[model samples]
Target chain A: MATELIKTRKLAVGYGPRGKVLQGIDFTIERGDFLGVMGPNGSGKTTLLKTLLGLLKPLSGTIETHAGGGGRPLFGYVPQRESLDTHYPLTALEVALMGRFGRIGMLRGPKKADYQLAHACLKQTGMDARANKPYRALSGGQKQRVLIARALASEPEILLLDEPTNGMDVSSEKAIMELLSELQKEKQTTVVFVTHLLHTIERYAHRVALITSDGSLIVGEKSKMLAPDVMARAYKEK
Target chain B: MIELIQVPFMRHILLAGVFVAAGLAPLSVYVVLRRIVFVGAAVAEVASAAVALAVLFQLAPFPIALALTVTSFLALSRLADSQRLPLESLIGMLYAGGAAASVLLITKAPRGEANILNILFGNILTVPATLLWAMAGVFGALLVFQYVAAKELLISAYDPDMGRTLGIPVRAWNMIFYGAMGVAVAIAIRAVGALLTFTMLVAPGASALCLTGRLNRAFLVALALGVVSAVGGVMLSYQFDLPTGSTIVGLLVVLFAISYGIGQLRSAA
Candidate 1:
């Protein structure tokens, strides 16, 4: 087993005074652990992912991670694509370069190395040819690639991607899954991916955490965790 | 016939027009993008109250006007962040409250009715010497700061979360931006007065956007447009003896209409 990278203890996740959507959830992820958060809609899977990334603070629990080098760990986060408004006056290269911000910090401009990283990430994501294009004009699949490049540019130890295959074609999905698998093998990077694809969960992820509507969390291998009875029971509570 | 543009005060108005072109174009662009033109109206109402208080205490209107504009702007922004109250409601309250206060203050003025109408619409070409110096200093600083921060500002305006993730303190940047806008409005009030000043702030910028459609290039176009309108407006005002700010803004409206027509023609093509 690799060293523990993210450890959350009894983390209860929800918005304020709204009551908890997820309660008494505990887990620790190690390097090389591909964890998939699986649940039905409004089952707190997304909220759990958000809680892990510190997007939303847990009402009652502790989430301790060794991110950043003495700063909050810079995780390459692929947020929900639907949440962003892509109609601004930015090019693909400029948007990709934003990922270097955690490394660069405020006030100071992007440096040579930052551009190099952005360029490299774009190449890796097959978005280099469209670097100068307006971001809003890109297709949904291309937009997803740009976002993935942004995450890669951050040089994060862990990648937290939300629905990485939402708008992707089958070939693109295969390409992405292969790339991610290769990245995990080469760098031992831990990925906490949130998706609803049962095949993807069975094929790519090493472990799965199933979140239920009543705030129950189940964590184990795919065979044990993805049984129809287990999934039905997991999603049955509302 | 006297050459008004040749005179220092007329030159100051031209120069101040040039200064406003730097920030107002992008400010207008963002306003249209963020769907927050109502914020501009809110600031204007708050500034009106400050204008009233300035007249009542016999205080110089510039400093007090600027302070009130920034304070109220910051308060509104914070209130927006907290979602404490709906923004439209707050703007309404500010408008009604300020109008009420100013009316009360204007009623108590020792002299006969201060021509509040003049303040509603500015007379730009008649700027005083001290006000000229203040415009030069403030406008110069904004120009340099904006040039350096332009890239970051453009990014933040579109995707604030992306900027935050990238380590741009977008909240702090926003405060600086709106505060600077308030300062610009205050500087404008010295000559054009409060109500009419939005013309200088909004018109040149809007026209530039309609014509060019690119952010950096739009600044140059807006600056040129502002100067042409001011210089041309002053000439017309001198010829007809009309209100200077009205003439300038009127010219701006004409230019905007023409530009909008041309833009539609181009886009349709």
Candidate 2:
């Protein structure tokens, strides 16, 4: 039986009490699920992602995240690339080392084992060659790879990415998706990503959750969710 | 310069300068990286206002300044996270308010203008032995905190959302960061005046960041440049009959220009 990592029922997510963006979101994210959240520009896809990660509060429902040993499940979150400031003079290795910071705990530094893991993750993401390079000096695709390496270094059970391929070229986007696909297949890492592109959901996601214009959600298998009638109705493009 | 160091007052000034630079320079790396330079400026301004308030109430300046600066730092940090207003706008309001309050509070104190000038431009020569010792203790603690919490602090500043997801109390860390910044600014303001303290907190970090691509190296280079600027400024001020605070700031600016040039050349190469 598939293990449920996150389950939300009758959830409403938004900025504040009156700022409801999405409502009645009921979904289950199982282990090893490649779930893609799709919607229009203002349809609250990112908001829902934030809600699931517990970064934002849900207006009226409960979000239960189940972990093996109880408590909140460990999440690896990759924020939008543009949201991060590049002015910081951190090397790529240093950026990846941040993933181990929580495990390293407070008032302590990263151990030798931590460095080895960070380096291994970077090498896994094909960013080992650029490990010593300044992060700001990297290309967009390379930076995204480094970010993925950072997330992977956390050894998270669930990986969440917000618009992971927002500004990438077709090849870079494909490469990143392929990498995520490989991780999911090999490690059974639960992956949830937010995107507005229907093609992305069709090509990559095993399951799809669509947010309509009126703040309602439709979630199902990718094959069913991508049906022409459902897509047309969800996007109000009929 | 040797003759100058022979004077007891000169020794006191140099020691005070070294302590202040050593503490503030390393913290400056975070301030610059986090892009909160104005927080340093506004905190220093508020600390000056606190000093003025101390003078008016016949209270000890250090404790009063520390209290006000830390409180103001925490408040500003909280407000900066709010989406209602731009962080820069809020910092500007605090800066203006603090500057106005300092001017108003000083007007009623005896030797008000001189005291105001001293607060604005520091009387390094007049620093007492007690204050020097206090600076050593305070700055020493700050250095140790920075060393131990280096990774946590960096993660908190660089990717707060990621930190939160990882169960790091980012808000609490932010509070600690601002509190440490408050303590540093308060003490440095007492030693070097508000303007010079602000300069020390920004210029060295900016220069070192320009010179080095690595964060650790930047911290070391910033510390070196800070000490050089402080020591050079003090000696030049004594030899040239210049204002010590202004001289330090001027030297730092010159060093920054040199560093920038070197960085640009290296990058071109």
Candidate 3:
């Protein structure tokens, strides 16, 4: 039996007053659920993710988290690899270590345990060999993997990703999906996978949410959501 | 070389240079990462405006300048997240407004233009002992704050979105970072003038970044570069009777150009 981790009730999210992109969003994510969020450009997929992560305020309604003593959940976010400036002077290990900052707290440096945990995260991501390599030096797939490791290093119960496979080749995308699948299977980590790729969602995601341009959603199991009619309905809702 | 330090005025200038270099150089690393290089200039402009205002009104310059710079920094920090207005426009607007305010205020005060010019182009040699002590005390506190909060500051700067998700109070941290910057700008303006203070905030860190891809090492290198430029520029100015602030700024510019050239070659090779 899966425990409910997060729920949204009649939710509305966007920028400020004039920037309402999505509204009336209602979804329940169980612990260890692989939620694939699909939407076209400007379809408010990222806005939904941001709202769920509590990075952006919902215009209305509510998103309740049950992760910590039935309070706000600690989230690990894997933003688009492109979101980071590659030119930044950081190593993969250093990047991974950043995840621990939340746990380690401020007013002090990282302890020995933090470094060990960061290395373990890097190793899990198959990046321990290149841990010392500068972040900018990594390939697209390697960067994505390191970013995932960074997120995992936080030891979050729920992980949210935005376009994790945006500019990758076929194998890289496949590798990332497989990694996510393994994490879900082994750790029962709740994952929110946001992307535009339909086939990947159909293959790896247990559930899929297709957001229409008009801020509506069609959500269900991948088999149901990825059907031809359902997909076409989602696409033609502009 | 020995004679330069023998004079009390020159000794005060060197100490002031040390304080500015030690304080601003380490802080510049974040400035480079945050890509708010010109925020220093904007803050300096506000400081200059405040100084002119103080002079015109017969009020205290340091306190007024610091207060105005800190206020501007707070405004900038709040505007940093606004999607409606680009940050550059706001900074540019502040820069223009401050410069114009300084000119306007100067026009109404006796011997104001000359005094304003002096504020704009600082005379490091004339730094008072009291101001030197003040620089040391304020900058020392700032350095400690930065040291204790280095990791948090780094995460907040490099990826603020991630910082927020990780429960880092990014806005508060940003305010702290900018507050330190305002204080640095306020202090350095008296020693190196507005233009050189801006240059110090940007150039050393930029040059260090070009030379290395390691963060801690980059910091040390930047600090070293800042000290070298500060001490070297002052010595050169003393020897050649050139403007001290401009000379230091010139050295930093030269170092940046050289580092960039070397970086390009390294990448190409």
Candidate 4:
């Protein structure tokens, strides 16, 4: 009884005319699904995530998203930590409050309930103690947690994260994965993430999509996708 | 200082300086935080060029300057996502082109050399009453816009991709932000000159961010620094018979240096 949230049919995505990275991609993301996108470097993993987020236009084909209320599905995106500039003097709480910006609408400020939600998200990510701390002063792991808090503060139906545990120690990575796991179970939130770490997919993802260097995609349940021969065939194309 | 303030013309100059500082200071916070300081210089230069063109054509300076600066800012906004060239490179091109155009166009006009000097160094002492009123009106409107849209502007500038995912219409917001900044720069050039306008956009924000290290407090600190530098620079200039625009820029640079040193010490401790 999986509820399909997003479906892509023969979708082609890339930068432009000369930058066709992936083609003939088909996938469906369902509610409460933990989906992992995996590939080698420059294999269109991030591009696919960007395409799903509507940050980039598809080169060809169509993406259809069905939300319960009949409007565009709300998304909470956690970009790579390095993509953000640390020069801003925003506190963690302030950064998290950005999630409420759209809901707060134009020409309006955050209200008391918005602040309460942001604080609650920060606490969920174990960052409540440092809510007032400068984001730049945080360590890599703490910064990642704050970013997760920011995403969660949006209260999105689908959470899309790009390399959430990138550049973290093993323990930090495990802790982040565990936190995400707990959130998925507790909230029944749909999760889609891009990762180069196979173990991350093998452990947490219900389904996995592998993008090869030849611009082909292989997607299936994690049990079949994580098989040694299947993984070897995908990596061999690189 | 009291004696200087008692004079009608001196009071007008002080009022003009305060208006320009108040308008540009809060914007300076965004300019510094977003690291688009060169964009400010480019806009100011383009506005100056427009002024030169208007003078050559016997047209009103402010309208033409506002139109051209706003147009140029909108054009430059397209480069934000360009992969072929960095935005800074394009902005640098605009800066150089504007500077050259101003010089070349001014040379063909009557009293062109004097006009060029005025645009560069500003003739703040002789600012007309009409221009003062315009500055007050425009800057007041800009202040209100900034206050109302502060949260949206901050989120859009800080993480545009995330903003996009949140359905923020980041590009449109950016265009509006740049457009407002263009209006401020255009008015500021008329009040203080191109060079001082650029300095006001960068220095106060940089100094305040360094000192406060908090976004909420940074705007107030930046405004205070801007007003202090403007008033201090004017007084020092009158006392020393120095150039007013240059004096203001110098004071801001000094303030920035002091703030940077203090910020370093605070971080170390």
A28-110: candidate 2 lDDT, tens digit per residue: 99989999999888789888988888888899999987886676778988888888889788889999988998898788899
Residue-level lDDT of model 1, residues A69-97, one tens digit each, is 65456678887677676535466887788
lDDT of 2 at B56: 90
Q: Every model's DockQ, to 2 decimals?
A: 0.33, 0.85, 0.84, 0.86
| Pairwise lDDT winner, candidates 2 and 4 | 4
Which regions of candidate 1 deviate over 4 angstroms? A68-71, A167-182, A196-204, B83-93, B104-116, B203-224, B235-242, B258-269
Worst 10 residues of 3 chain B by lDDT: B110-119
| Fraction of native contacts (fnat) of each candidate | 0.15, 0.87, 0.87, 0.83
lDDT of each: 0.72, 0.87, 0.87, 0.88
lDDT score of residue B144 within candidate 3: 86
Q: Residue B177: error of model 2 in Å?
A: 0.8
What CAPRI-style quality would you assign to candidate 1?
acceptable
Candidate 3, residues A154-237, lDDT tens digits: the string is 999899999988888999999999999999999988899899888788788999988876787768998888888888866885
Cα lDDT tens digits for candidate 1, B1-269: 25766676666766555555443544665665555566666667666667778777888766777898888776765555453466678767777876777688778765413545445555565667777677778877876767777756665566665566555677777777767877776676655665446665676666776676455666677767877876677678768988766777788889889988887887687
TM-score of chain B of each: 0.87, 0.94, 0.95, 0.94
Chain A fold similarity by TM-score, each prediction: 0.91, 0.97, 0.97, 0.97
Clashes of each: 3, 0, 0, 0
Model 1 lDDT, full chain set: 0.72
For the predicted complex of model 3, DockQ is 0.84
lDDT of 4 at B254: 99
